[model samples]
Target: MSGFQIGKDIISYVALGDSFTEGLDDPHPDGGNLPQGRYRGWADRFAEHLAGHVGELRYANLAVRGKLLRQIFTEQLPRAVELRPDLVTLCAGGNDILRPGSDPDTLAEAFEAGVDRLRGAGADVVVFTGFDTGFQPVMKHLRGKVATYNMHLRAIADRHGCSVVDLWSMKVLQDRRAWSADRLHLSSEGHRRLALRVCEVLGVPVEGDWSEPWPQVPPLPWREARQEDLQWARQHLVPWIHRRLTGRSSGDGIRPKRPDLEPLG
Candidate 1:
């Protein structure tokens, strides 16, 4: 990837991906309250930050809650091209890699092809590496796969001259507070920090710092932590597995929050 050069004027930007990009757990704040069904994920926050720098930016988010990589290819890619945005940010394949028997190599191959299409569309593309799963009891098992995929992502970015956000190297995300109760989606602070990271990678001037240290708090006792894990397993993990088994999706009836590029104001 050539990387996001400074002073690039991104008049229009679009984001493509799954639940992580959909901002599932992060409720967009309304005044002082956080209303349900309102999500402003990292991409949205980054869009706002970008608008502040570039001025009069139009942004659209095409990410759904449970899309696989192939679905993103078939669904989001064509629409993204049609938009002909000045910049495109894509963070997909996490859902695919979480499934059983999924092959990172095959996933990377398809991912590379998608990058090619976005670049070919004449948009400066940004891609993300999967976060380190080392913090999760279940996901820690997939560390090797995540690492392999991350390697491929860096290589792909290099080949295509794209800007890259390496989540695998973000130590701030390793903290439990950065995650929501579901232990799947990120919390509000997490999204904000990620937005800062995006600005840093893009060489854009943003208000906050992503590397700010987490507030020091006493760690949860082993008993409480395990209890939380069990609860998450029942509430989130089980439901996710059920969907996989039944071929259902959280995004089944849901539509993109921002289907068209709208002025950020």
Candidate 2:
């Protein structure tokens, strides 16, 4: 366990954002029982860790899949404020970064407003920057946009006295294993490691390391790799583009899994 500590006990935590916060692709046994397909993501895992430390933790996850920063700022922020949580984690703007013609500066401004409001309500806030996507075959083009957004997010975190989980520097996440089959959300193991990282950022005591290396595997043959890429584009990328063109979101009509701050299991 790391010696670093936040010192302040967190009794209530409210998470706000999109699919990453919503825990997409990290399926849990009981996930189907929750609202919005509710796969257990890093936020839920983080809450569980805190519960282990404090013996009681009230947690709420207001994130929904495919939400842009503006939607989160408008729909989730007010509810988070009403909860009056002791801790808040915001990880929005990712979907916005993926959209064509989206401006990172404008998104950052909206994000900062939410952070300031949460901090003003006396809650310790945590924010996450996007990961370095240079290694991803389909996502490399968006790397610059992600980097730009990360810079703005870091500045906002500093301005608001908020904790920052700098995913851009997390080398472990560069592994292909960290991503799901769709090449969008993190896999279950990836989500687990991310939870560990968040705990580390908060200075919370943790038993395991997120940086443990994955077992090595032989690289795919050139033909096989090309085939996989084609399949991914067909199964995931095309649908995503369709959604964008149709002005529809994957989160349409979906509700948060854990909308109310209730004791963590």
lDDT of 2 at 182: 95
* Candidate 1 lDDT, 131-176, residue by residue in tens: 9999887899999999999899989999999889999989999998
Candidate 2 local lDDT, 1-265, one digit each (tens): 1122344454888999999998999987675665536689899899888887774688999999999888998999999999998888899998988878998888888888888899888788988999899998677999999998899999998887888898999999998899898989999999999999998888778999999999999999999989998998899999989998999999999998889999887
Clashing pairs for predicted structure model 1, backbone only: 1-157, 1-158, 1-161, 1-162, 2-161
The Cα local distance difference test for each model comes to: 0.88, 0.87
TM-score of model 1 (CA atoms): 0.94
Off by over 4 Å in 1: 3-10, 31-36
RMSD in Å for model 1: 2.1
Off by over 4 Å in 2: 1-10, 32-36
